[model samples]
Target: MAPRSSRGKSIRQRGARPPQPRAVSAQDLGKLQGLAGLSLRKLEALRARMRIRQFSRHSTIYKEGDESDDAVYIVLSGIARLVCLNRKGKRNLLEVLGPGDVIEIPSLLPDIHHKLTCETFTDCQIGLISPTALVEGIVGIPFREFNEALNLTVGRWWTLLERHSNFLSQTVREKIMLALLDLGRKFGRRDEHAMIVDLGLSGQDLADLVESSRPKVSECLKSLVAEGVVKREHRRFIIDSVRIQTSLRS
Candidate 1:
C-alpha cells in the first residue's frame, strides 16, 4: 500500500478490521423465524399471548427511562433502531435491529426501565409478546435454557456497546470507516473482490451514524477512493475489502 501522503489523507482515516457478522439468510427475512425451535404447543401459547403491532417510519416505540411494560417486541419486518442521546440532546444511532431480532430484551423484566430509545425507520410490523407467554414459549421446564437465552440477549447489547464506543473514541476518519464497516457487514454483498453495501445510505445517513458532519464524511470517502480502498459503481458503494482491511494498517 502506498503512503497516505499521496492522497493527502491522514492516518486517522484508517480502520482496524472487525470480524464481520454473518451474511443474513432466509432465517433473517422476518416473522420471528429465529424462534423456530419451539414446540407447536409452546408456539400456540405464544401466539395466544402476543399481538401484532404496526408503526410508520420515524415513529418512536419508546424513549429512554420509559417504563418497561413487562413485554418484548420482535421485528417482523423493516428496521427498528435503538438510539442513545447525549447531554446536549444529540441523537446517536447505537444499534439497528432488523427482521428477527428482539428489541431491548432486558427491558422485558419486571420493574425495569429502558435506557435506549427504539423507533422504526420504515413502516414496520412487530410482534408484541407478554412476559409470561414469552417465558412459557422459550423456557418451559428448562431453567438453564432460559438463562442461556438471557445471556445471548445481553451479549448482543454488549457487542453493540463495544462497537458504539469504538466509534466514539476514534478519529473522524476512523469513525467513518467503522460506520461503513458496520453498515456493510449488516447489509452488504460480496462478489469477487468488492463488498457492496446495499443500504442506500446517503451522506447525511452516514453523518448521523458517526455523529460527524456530512462534508467531513465526503472528504473521508474521497480519501478512501484516492487510496484505492473503495469505489463507486452506479449508485452503490463498493469497497475493496482486502485493501481496506490492511490499507492504513499496511
Candidate 2:
C-alpha cells in the first residue's frame, strides 16, 4: 500500500469536518424585493421561519402539479427556467427568472400546486418563506400591496404568452428576432459597442423559448448575422439594438 499522506493523517487525528453553509439571516430576507422596505421587526419575524437552499445548475427545483402548499420560493441569485411539458412530452419554455423573482404563483395560494416546472439554469441560491407567516399577518405588510405585486408578475407572463401566441402568424426569423429583443431586455448588459446577452442557453433552449425548431432557429440566427443585427460570441450574443429595431420596423 502507498504511504498515507501527512495532511490526511493530521485531519483524521483532528476529527475535522467540512465547513457548513451560513444560516439564512434577516438581511438575506431583505434582499428579496417583496420583503424590502419592511419593518425590522417584521423582517426578523419572517427571517426566523425562512429556509435557505442551494441548487446545482440543471437540477429540478419543482415540477408542475407538485404540491406547494407550504412556502413561497424567492430566487436570491442566478437564473431559473419555468417550463411546461405537454401531453406529447415536448417542453415549452415559459419564462426565465433571475435574482429577486418569485419562482411560482400557485405555490402561494392554498390547496394549489406548481403550474410550471422550475429548473435551475445556473447554480442558484433560493429562500423559502412560510405561507403561515404571510397569511397570519406576521410580516405586517399591506395585503393589497402584496397581491398587486403578485398580479403584476403574472401579468408579465400573460403578456409574454400572448406575444408568442401571435408569433404563430409571423415568420420564424421575426419570432427569433423578437425573442432575442425580449431576452436582451431581461438579461443583457450594455457595452461600448452593443448589448451582450449571456444567458448561457443552448440552441434547443432558444427554440423552445420561441416555439420553433432548432434547425429553423439556426437558420434565422444566420440571417440575423447577415443583417448585422446580432453576432455570436461563444455562448453569448452581441446585439446591435438600433439595427434590430430598424429591421423589426421594416
Candidate 3:
C-alpha cells in the first residue's frame, strides 16, 4: 500500500464540500438582452463558447474590405463609429454606435465585402461570437429572437439613410443643431444647466459628419459660441440645451 501523506490526512480531517455552481440571476439575463437579444438560456450557452475583446480609442476594429472569417461583434461598452472614406480621403461617418450595437454583420452575406471600417471612439468592451458558432446558436433560438435581431438591424440602416438625407438637405446651422442634439441624446452628461457632449471631435471631423467644409464648420461654431448656444473648452463642444433649442427657432 502507498504511504499516506500529511496533506491527504488534513483534507480528510476538514471534510471539504464540493464547490457549488453559480446560479444565474435575473439582472444578468436582462443585461444580456441588450447585448444581443439573448435569452437567459442562450446567454449561458454563449458564455461558455464566445470570446470577449477590448479596444482602445482610435483603434481600428476592422478595415474596409477585410475578410470576414472570424466572428460578429456586439458593443458592450463605449462608442464606435462606422465610416467610409471617399476618393478624396474624406471620411463619411456612417453611424456612431453605442452599447448594444452589432458590428460586422454586412460581411456575413455571400460574396459581399465589408463596405465600412469600424473604429473605437473610446475604450470599449466587445463580445464576439464566431460566425459558425452564431449560426449554430441561432438554430437553437426561437424564431422570434432571430426576427427581432433582423428588425433591429433593418431599423438602424433606415435611420442611417435618413441621417444622410438630412445632412444633404440641412443648412450649416441646422446641421450643427442636429449634430448637437444627436450627441446629447447618445453621449451627453447632464449638468445643472445643460447636456454636454463629452467627446473631443476635431472641426474637420465635425465637418465630415455634417457634409460641410471645415471652414464653414469653424465659422458656424464661432457664431454659436457668440450666441451663447455653445461653448468650446479645449477640444470639446458644450451645448447649452435651452439656448440651442431657442436658437433653432429664431
The best candidate in terms of lDDT? 2
Relative to the unseen true structure, what is the C-alpha lDDT of residue 37 in candidate 3, on a scale of 0 to 100? 63
Off-target runs (Cα >4 Å) in candidate 2 are 1-46, 85-89, 109-114, 135-187, 198-217, 240-250
Clashes found in each candidate (C-alpha, N, C closer than 3 A): 0, 0, 0
Q: Write the per-residue lDDT of candidate 3 for residues 7-97, one digit (tens) a residue.
A: 1121111122223323333344347435446665766666656566666655666665546435677776676667665444545565666
Give the Å shift of residue 34 in candidate 1. 4.4
lDDT against true structure, model 3: 0.62
Worst 10 residues of 2 by lDDT: 6-15
Encode model 1's per-residue lDDT on 4-39: one tens digit a residue. 232222112113222232322323332254566656
lDDT of 1 at 227: 85
Name the candidate that leads on TM-score: 1
- Global local distance difference test of model 1: 0.59
lDDT of 1 at 3: 26
How do all models score by TM-score?
Answer: 0.61, 0.59, 0.54
lDDT of 2 at 11: 9
